[model samples]
Target: MSACSVFDRIFMAGLVEMNLSFASKYGAKALGR
Candidate 1:
């Protein structure tokens, strides 16, 4: 594949990971309360 495609995949992965982290952090706090 191309470099751009590789970068996009990495970017998307980071984005998903960040979202999951944010969601889990907030979700746990919300549930705890």
Candidate 2:
């Protein structure tokens, strides 16, 4: 595997984690309404 591929994988994983956290936060706010 190349360095670029490794970097891409890490970037994607970070995005996924960010999305999950954001979604959970939004969901909690919606439920609170």
Candidate 3:
């Protein structure tokens, strides 16, 4: 695979991880309320 494609995959993975963490935090706050 090309370096550019590999970098793009890593970037997408990072975004997905960030979104998952953000969602979990929001869910926890909602539950607390």
In order, candidate lDDTs are 0.98, 0.97, 0.97
Best-performing candidate as measured by TM-score: 2
Model 2 residue runs over 4 Å out of place are none
- Considering TM-score, which of the candidate structures 1 and 3 is the better prediction for this target? 1
TM-score of 3: 0.83
Off by over 4 Å in 1: none
Clashes of each: 0, 0, 0
TM-score of 2: 0.90
Listing every candidate in turn, what is its Cα RMSD in Å to the true structure after a full C-alpha superposition? 1.2, 1.3, 1.3
Q: Residue 10 lDDT in model 2?
A: 100
Better of 1 and 3 by lDDT: 1
Candidate 1, overall lDDT?
A: 0.98
Residue pair clashes in candidate 3: none
lDDT of 3 by residue, 1-33 (tens): 899999999999999999999999999999995
Quote the lDDT for 8 in model 1. 100
User: Which residues of candidate 3, in runs, are more than 4 Å off?
Assistant: none
